[model samples]
Structures are given as structure tokens and as C-alpha cells.
Target: MTAEEETRTAAPAERLWDLAGRWHGVAVAAGILVLTRVVQILLLVGLDRAIPDPAGLRSNLLIWDGGWFQRVAAGYPQGYTYAQNGALEGNELAFFPLYPMLIRALSAIGFDPGSAALAVSWLASLGAAVALHLLGTSLFKSRRAGWALVGICCGAPMSVVLSMAYSESLFLALVAGMLVAAHRRVWWAAGLLGLGCALTRPTGAAAAVALAVAALVAIREHRDEKKWPPLVAAAVALAGVPAYLGWVGWRVGEVDAWFKIQTAGWGTSFDFGDSTIGFLSDTLTLADGWVPMSVALILLVALAAAGVALAGRPWLPLAVYGIVAMILVYGQAGYYHSKPRLLLPVLLTLLPAAAAAARARPRVAILAISAWAAFGLWYGAYLVAVWPYTI
Candidate 1:
């Protein structure tokens, strides 16, 4: 009945209420994600109906990367090898295991691998939207801003990749989860998520670096740092790299299995200088002829600029992740066409802007996001159904 006791008791209840309030944005994001997935499914179904056998259409509908992932999921890895012209080649080592792993697990329970892959990816995409909402809410200190950020990400052109059997949705979910855990200073969770991210895609390295840097900064700031959570996070995040590398090394008797496979098999070499210049030149030169290429290039520049602008803010984690992501994508010697999808995670930069936008004009933010989502839906449908033929 004392005032201090009442205040203490009330504080916890207030915090719970605040947390509940923030999740409204997550619900809204879920709605948007579901709607987008539904649209994609409808388009796919329509396409399937139009083309009974759909064999020839498959080549156009499911081009390069998607076919590789499907083949891997279908248990045809034996036909694949690490080297391109080294005789053994299919898809075994070329693609990472996480996505296929999910497909396999789902298939074990009687689901078709391809359908399972798509289903798992769809769910992961929803999880990613939720994670983005949470991340934005945490960074901007507003639920509205969080919702706006989720809308932007879900509506972005890259959102179409989520429907595919690709690792983007899975990776995005892991990365976003890692970011949220890091923002809360929950080192163990963040580290675990970081490890999961590494397992998902190459960008996992960027997530690991961002988490490690954040942890180091937290340690340096705390004079009596007895807990050492950040260090724990960094260690956990890094554990996956060595474990993965060691496995690959043991399997192939090479410490550089990953690098070699990446280079030789996928034509992904790390030529920092030429890679950066080529990306810029190609982007500028091809900007007029190709719409996707142009949008990707502009988005890359926008993300880089956003990172720089937000670097001084309290949310240094976002800037760190964005900068590292941009650097990684720009450093790639091949897959230049994928620069847009590669920069998907960097869209986290939009969180800060979303927060500011929410404070100034929440309606404007929502409207813009809606427009983008509409475009993404239309573009994704077109790509799956029509654009593949044109290409």
C-alpha cells in the first residue's frame, strides 16, 4: 500500500501493455504478407491451368537459380559437384543446405518437396514481415513506424523472391530476428539467430559481423562488464562459420572449400576493385535499357545513402548492418543481376526513415508502402507468368 511498492508493481504492468501495443503493427504486417502470398498463388495456379503440361513453360517460369534449388530439394545432389568443369556437377554443393533441408524435412512428413519448399518459404516470408515490424518498432520507438517498415519491405520488388524456393525469406527472418535480439541486448538469442542466418545465405557473414561489432561496443561501454553477453553473442555467431568451414574442409580436404566452390562452381569470385567498378558501370550503363537493373541500382545507392545519413543516430546497429551488406554485395564479382535481391537485407535502412515518416506523416508512409506492395504484386505475377519468356 506504500507509494513506492505501488509504483514498482505498476511499472511491470505498464511495460507489458507497451509490448502488447507494439504488436498491433505486427498483425497489420501479417495481413499484408498474406495478401501478397495469396495473389502470387493465384497467379501460379492460373498459369498452371493455362498450360496443362507446363513443361516448356517450366523452363521460362522457373529459370536458373530456382531450377537449381528445386533440383537440390528433389535429392539430385549427387549429380552436382563443387567444380564447374571438373566432371561432377549438378547442384549438391552449389546451393547451401538450409532451404533444401527444410524441404526434405517437410517431405519426410509426406509433403511434396517442391510444394513444401514453397510453403516453408511462404511462412518464412510472413515471419520476416513480423520481424521487420518488431525491428522497426524497437528502433523507432513507435509501433506505427514498425508497421510502415514492414509494409515497405513486403511491398518492395524483392518481395517476389519470397514466394520462390529461394533462401531470401528464411535469411530475412533470421537476420531480422538477430537484429531484434541485438537491439534488446539479448546476446545469446542474437548469436543463435546469427548462426541460423549464416546457414541460410552468404549474407549471414554480414549479420555475424554486425552482431559482433554491436556486442564489442556494448562491452566497451560497460566498465564493470561482468555478464559478457555481447561476447557470448559474438562467439555464438562465429561458431557456425568454423563449424561449416570445418565440415566442408573435412569433406573435401580443403580449408577453402567454400571460397573455391563459390568461385569455381558459381563463378563468384571476390575481386573487390573490379567488382565494385563493374557494378557501378553496369548499373549506370544499363539503367535505361533494363527496368529491374535500374531499380536495383537506385535502391543500392539509396540504401548506402540512408546508412550514411543514419550512422550518427543511436541505432548504429542498422547502419552497421546496412553498410556491411552493401559492401558484401558490391564486392561480388559475378551475379551482378542479383544486386537488387542481394541488397534485400539492407532495406532495414528503411526502418529509421519509416520511424521519422511515422512521426511526421504516418498516412503518407502507409500510402507509399501500399503503392510499392501493389507494384511488387503485379511485377511478381508478371515475372512468374510473362517476363520469363521475354528474358
Candidate 2:
């Protein structure tokens, strides 16, 4: 082709390239998250065929807590037995509202509960990745660091939950969105996202602590403004746990109905890590011959410790969120074996390691991320496929 023709042809491609370059941060993060979800979907598809469940493909992505969410989305149908005398002593109260509500909305439009929940989860995971890209890039001032953070988030062992009909994806999206907004000093937006986060998970109260910390930091740095918005954000976030607990209490006709549900129904409460320590002890002693379980638990604890040690290096809000989230997750007397999955919402816990990986030489970073991705790619499948543990 002539020079003129070549230039003309390249113009269209140039514009496309420019647009893509402008969106590189969000695109990269979303791409990685999507890629992970695709892998998970593929695994689930295979699992569906291998197992002869009537729901088939729909059931693969809606296991465990996903099942509970589906039940809630259906408005506690007549057969749902998690309720006791109008009080929830079962898994129903243990689950939050926002996720089920979203699924419910989609299901109303003719989609099945499981499929709707899975689709929403997939989209939310991508949204979470995009917001995380913004926060990571802004906090660390390095694109590599931002992408690394996304990688860590997507590659964590429990990241498999992101693809399932679970609240982690939606919760993370709102959380990361609020954090990004706070970093940008968009107080109103932060406050709004904080509200959604509040409704998404019980641990969402961490958003309040984090937002309050951010507000205080802003005050210290003389950058405070729109004071009401930050305060509102903090208030809403702080209210989430109590509000849910209060509702549970009212419904169950006991002030501590929620706590009772967690304890009697789910075997979860505040024992200050005693149960965790005991579980670790049992696993390490080979009483169950599940040495790998012990190893996984140890690594998770190490990750939390390492994350805290590294938290001091990140933005103050992130540090507060990570620290408080970890405390809330582990301080409670929840299922010890579910620690890794339960802690999935604490995305900041991966920031320090992610930053380290980003700063390393290119090949080293690739190796680090590749290893993480490898483990996460299969771990969820194994949990669902081979093991009969709580997913």
C-alpha cells in the first residue's frame, strides 16, 4: 500500500490503542479477574458433567454459602427450615442481605437464583478489580504495584469464592470503590459506597474503621473537607454490623439473637482464637492425617502476620482496614477450617506481599504471581471436588 493509505489505515488502530492505553489500569485488573473467573467456570463446567446433579451447570457455582444465599433470595419459602419459630438459629441469619437481594432482583426477571447469583458475582468481581486498580495505583503511586495488588487479590486461595454465588465479590467491589473514592477525596462517593458495603457483609464494619482513620488522617494533614460526608461514611459503615445484629435480635425476640444464631446454628462466636488454636493443634498432631490442612492454616496465619507487619508501609486507611478486618475474622469463634475463606474480604492483607512482588525484578514478580495463580486455580476445585469440607 502507498504511504498515504498506510497512514490512513493506521489511524483507526492508533485511536483504539490510545483508548486502551487510557484505560490500562482498569482494563488490566479487570482482565486478570475475568481470566480467573473463566478458569473457575471451566472447572465448574467439568465438575457439573462429572457429577450427576439435576441442576447441572447451575449448581457448580452455587455451592455451600451460595446455597444459603439462594434460599434467602427466594424469600424463605415454605420448605426453608433454617428458621425456628420466626427466629433464625440456622444459616439464614448468618448470611447478609445485599447479595441475596441482588440475586432476588435478577431472579425476579426469570433467571434462576443460582445463575443470577453467579452472574452478579462475576460482574462484581470485575468491578472490584477495577476499583482495586485505582486504589492500589493511587496508594502506591506505581502501576505495577496496583496490578500486583489485583493479582494477589485474584490469586489468593479463597479467591475461588469470587466466582461462586458469594458476597465477597460484591463486598470487595463496594469496599475498594469506597477506598478509591476516599483516596480521591470524593467524600460523598465514599460515604455512598460505604453504605453498600455495610449491607454486604458483617465485616463491612471495617470500612467504618478505615474510613474514620482516613478522615482523621485527612484532618491531621489539613486536607479535610466535606466533613459531613466522611462522618456519614464512618457512621454508616459502623452501623452495618449493629444494624444487622439488631434486626436479627428483633426478629428472633432476643437481644442476642444474632449471636445465638452464630453460636447455636453455625458454631461461631467470640472465643478470641481459642478454637483456632485448638484446631491448629489437632491438625498439626496428625489426628486426622490431613497434614496439608495444617500447612494451609499455618500459611494463612503467616500471611496475616506478614500482612500486618507490612501494613505499616501502606496508606493508613488500608492499614487500619487490614488490621481490623483480620482481628474480626480471627478473633471470633468461627469454624477454624473456614478461616481462609472467611478472610477473603480482607483484600488489604495481600497488599504488602503484592507490593513486594511488584518491586521485585520482572522475572521474579512473574514467578511469584504465577505461583500464586497456580495454587488458586486448583484449590477451590479440589475443595469442591475431592474434599467434603465447608467450601
What TM-scores do the predictions have? Answer: 0.83, 0.86
Candidate 1 lDDT over residue span 1-391, tens digit each: 6798567535633543375264565578798788777776566566655654653433433455666666667663322263445553333565666777887888889986667777788789988988877777676667776677777776666566777767889999999889887776667788889999877777777788889888877767765544576888877876765676566666766776667667765567777748667656776776745665655565566666576556646466666787778777777776554666676677555655575557767677767767767776666655556444321
lDDT of each: 0.69, 0.73
Model 2 lDDT tens row, 1-391: 6798567535633443343234876688788888877776676566546754534545556777888898888764322235546754565776778899999999999988888998889889888887777767767666677778888778777788888888999998999888877776666777778878878887788887898888777666754233565677677667877887787777766787667666766778877777766777667676675635744564466566555656467777877887788777767876665777767767666766767876899789978897877777667665665455675
Error of 1 at 16 (Å): 7.9
Candidate 1, residue 224: how far the Cα is off, in Å = 5.3
Q: In each prediction, how many residue pairs overlap at the backbone (N, C-alpha, C within less than 3 A)?
A: 2, 1
Q: Which window of ten consecutive residues has the lowest lDDT sum in model 1?
A: 76-85
Native-vs-model 1 lDDT? 0.69
